[model samples]
Target: MATVDRVEIEQAQKLWQPQPGWLNTASYGLPPEPAWTAVQDALADWRVGRTSWEGWGEATERSRAAFANLVGVPVADVATGAVVSQLLAPVAAALPPGATVVAPEVEFTSNLFPWLVQAERGVRVRTVPLAKLVDAIDAGTDLVAFSLVQSADGAVAPYDEIVAAARAHGALVAVDATQACGWLPFDAARADVVVVGAYKWLMAPRGTAFAYLAPDLRDRLRPDAAGWYAGEDPHASYYGPPLRLAADARRFDISPAWFSWVGTAPALDLLAEIGVPAVHEHNVALANRFLAGLGRPPGDSAIVAVEVPGARERLERAGVRAAVRAGRVRASFHVYSTSDDVDLALNALTG
Candidate 1:
């Protein structure tokens, strides 16, 4: 297991001052001061036309580089977009007719819908329990797509096992890391494609998303959503004609939502500096504390699903923000969460 410095965690914690009862990072992360300030500044600039859009656009590259660093991939392999489905569109479009996709039955729609929509093209999407996901990938499977951490139950995927299985069967691996990327340390390069929504664990504005495309996968897909942003030189491509796209994964890029990227760049940079190992250590510790308080077995994930009666009402009454998913109250801990936040949710449930 990787170890992180307590000092680093402490310094990272100082970047955010979320309210005492924010346990809903699984739904959306509360941005740190820098991210919020960046967004605010960008909005102000937009309102007055005080600065050139070029300055705002620069943030997209910073965000792309930061996300690449966080996922342990080359910057050239990363592409920016507005959402997971948008990022995954090219991958979905690349599937051949009669191809089979295996995914969890309860997967969040962003990861599942794109594949399912391909039914008209003879693209078959097979749904199974998440625990059976690896076993479901076989000779017939063309692709295996799943979330790194389940949104409803907070179950961590068995990543290595799935990757090995996909490799053995020659199936492409597409991962949605929206719920896990910021705090979960894993190599995005292991998969054919990895898409992430920056709003949840990455603590960025909702419109920003990213994808990592392996060299082979990048070559396989068409840049279906290409625009000026996907060009070899965006400013030069503004007028038209030759259609010179980027030679790398940037060819798949969607024009970024500028203010969102401005907010995202600092958030991702902060997470990269703090390191996922440290964030994971802090977040999981708090999650385990909450689980223990509920008299439940400790879990390795930073998100916990509480099934006790009135869990949602109790947390709401106590001003502890959380979400009810699949009939259970989901509470997620992150870099800013502490023992006090866990205790507050515990008291709300048990008191």
Candidate 2:
């Protein structure tokens, strides 16, 4: 649990050059210089046919290992994919007939739809208020799924309580870390399945995602989207034959989008170097500063939902970038965000 010092945070901050008014990281992140450069280099190679596909594929492994390290999991337990829903598909498919899942009522559709779609097979999904999520898990609950941080409002889940409840009920735990990963320090290994769509918080390209499947959970899931990429040896697995897949979570991998991985590798590597605890401290401080300016109490989350009248249009007019979610102005802070960014948003809304 090494924490990064100010020097390290300053060094990491130099890697990105986000515009001063940028506050919409919850929607998408601006890539760090290394990641942007890596993607550009890979795209150049693709344009000229200067390198073989094998070279591009190497980035996928790099990204997978980096994501595993970021989440405190072994690489063997990690699976790579292009989106959160795609990665969760097999987990959803693994549900037993008549199984029940408990989730937050406002969960992003990517996590909710997969389980809800199982209704035709007798699997039931129960959605409750975020505050009631832990208490709602019962003996009949087969699994509990939720996001580490809510996308619309930046509410952090009660991770320990939910996990304890799930364990008490002999229920499996699944978490989507899309909005929390790089800025929130938590043990992803505590969950049976952890999925991340890296584009938003990890500052990577949109096509990059990762999942960690605990060994027992991995055993239960079928690699429904397994392709040559999921093979024990991808190059050798091309063309039909007696099926051979990796013995680990890689068996769930989908064929990666090459340029996306090229960018993802460097971005994740940078985040790992800076340490999530450092990022969390920096981001939450900025968020609190903004909240204070707006005459609101400090919050634990880096994303703030400002409900002031005409907030979104004010931010837009002031050249501040933020999202409108659930009728509030959603402004998120990340490692690249500065106090200036927060001030800009505050001025827009308070002026």
Candidate 3:
């Protein structure tokens, strides 16, 4: 049994400014007051110089530890970054030359392009229909990259089964959790790699992301373009022989957007406080309300898509904010959303 504290959730909402009919957290999440305050505190520390240097380093590691806890992984396994694309490019480069990569055609481009671009290195990126994805992986498959939750229609991938299949074939698994992480819970233990951009459902500022690499997989990867920060001695004053890489996922790390890391640490801390299981419960309850209002069934993820004519104009005229994609009105829900937000979006579509 699991539970979310009502009083705590309401109290948490106070940290966020009220926004009417904003149901697009799947696009970009709004950071709460604490995150902004964290930025100010971080700025103040930097202005003070030497005395605050250790604090800056602590904040960065705090963010890594926070994200690790969020995804149920060890802190050493996680590495922060600027965005999903940048975090994933190295994972793509790590694959053996001429390996075959399988993915969904309708996935978010960040997850798709990195692998597709690998073709230039003799790696083949094959776009498989979702229905055929599990069956597509074989002995020759080097890696299977896909989203835990689809962004457009909010389709949740059957990853456990897929992971089992990929493992059976000795192929690696990498999951893009940008649309899934904070809102839904999954087992990252089964994955070789998990990547997420903090700006989306995690509710952190943009220019922040993290990747989790299983310890064994870390040895297999060769970061195509690592910087000085990616080294074991990131702050080392002098370079020497045997240019050292980090022992864990930090080998894939980059110079994080410092301010973004400041905000992200607090955002992740908030989620950890609320508990992901609780957030998932709240989001699913809101999704149910939105779906019932629209006469649709319980959806796979917090996102519910409906077909409506002139959908964009109607939603705008009614002051409802949602994404119109591929001729479907995609409404996404988060902890901050309420029943009224769902009703308002539904009324605009039905009215």
Candidate 4:
């Protein structure tokens, strides 16, 4: 059962400086006041010439636990990273040379480029349309890379079906859930590797992200880029001469941004307290409202995309916040967004 309700979520929205009909969370999320409070407390400790290793470490671990909970996985499966690119570099490198990677061409370029770049170095990268993605995977394919939700058009991918097919062929699956993590419920345990950029939907600051690697997959891949922090006892890494890495997913973690970790604790706590199912329900309702206002069938996604010419200018003049992607205006919803916010965006488009 959810401990927090719509009233509590609406109250939490007050912490963020109210936007002028903001609906653009898909591009970037608004920071809550609690996140700032956490950052300020950490900075104050830093100013006193006192480093709270315990406090800092606890914050980092708490973030890992929180993300694990969000993805329905154990904390041992989660690895922290400075950003998606840094985390994905190891994942991309882990693939056997000459492996075939299947991906959608229209996905967020971060999810696309890493796999595509492998083409230059003996790997086969096949870019296909989203509808054709499942058919592209077969016995010859070694990896399948894709976003959980299409960023440009807000289309949800057939993830479970794709994962099942990929697994049947001995292909590893990598998912970028940055766009879908907080607003939609997914079984993270299904993917071999799940990466999330926390700043967007997870409601954390920039410079924070995480990757979840299956226990078996961790041992199978070569730890070529494992840094000093990858070890079980990161502090003892310098004191001892042994270059031992963690037995679990921690081996993939890079040096994390401490401040972002501090902020992440509270942000994730808020969502967990509210419950993802509740948040998903709220955002879906708003998305449906927005679609209905436009007289379109609901796509059952938090993002409501419409093709509008001069979208940027029109939204700007109307004080409506949205993202322009692939010539479409994308207005995304969060638990904080209300029916009014959807109506405001709809009116801006039609009026």
Error of 3 at 88 (Å): 1.7
lDDT of 4 by residue, 204-257 (tens): 888889899888887776666577778887877756667788888888877667
User: TM-scores across all candidates?
Assistant: 0.97, 0.97, 0.93, 0.93
Cα lDDT, all candidates: 0.91, 0.91, 0.84, 0.83
Q: Model 1, residue 320: displacement in angstroms?
A: 1.0
Q: lDDT, candidate 2, residue 5?
A: 60
Q: After superposition, how far is residue 244 of candidate 1 from its true place, in Å?
A: 0.9
Ranked by TM-score, top first? 2, 1, 4, 3
Which digits, one per residue and each the tens of the lDDT, describe model 2 over residues 1-351? 224465677787888988789998999999999999998998998999998988889999999999988889999999999999988889999999999999999999999999988999999999999999999999999999999999989999999999999999999999999999999999999999999998999999999899999999899889988889999999899999889999999999999899999999999888888788888988998899998999999999999887888876888899998887555888899988988888888888888
Model 3 regions more than 4 Å off: 1-4, 43-54, 237-242
TM-score of 3: 0.93
Supply the TM-score for candidate 4.
0.93
Q: What's the CA RMSD of model 3 in angstroms?
A: 2.2
Query: Which 10-residue span in candidate 3 carries the lowest summed lDDT?
Result: 50-59
Checking candidate 2 for backbone clashes, the offending pairs are none
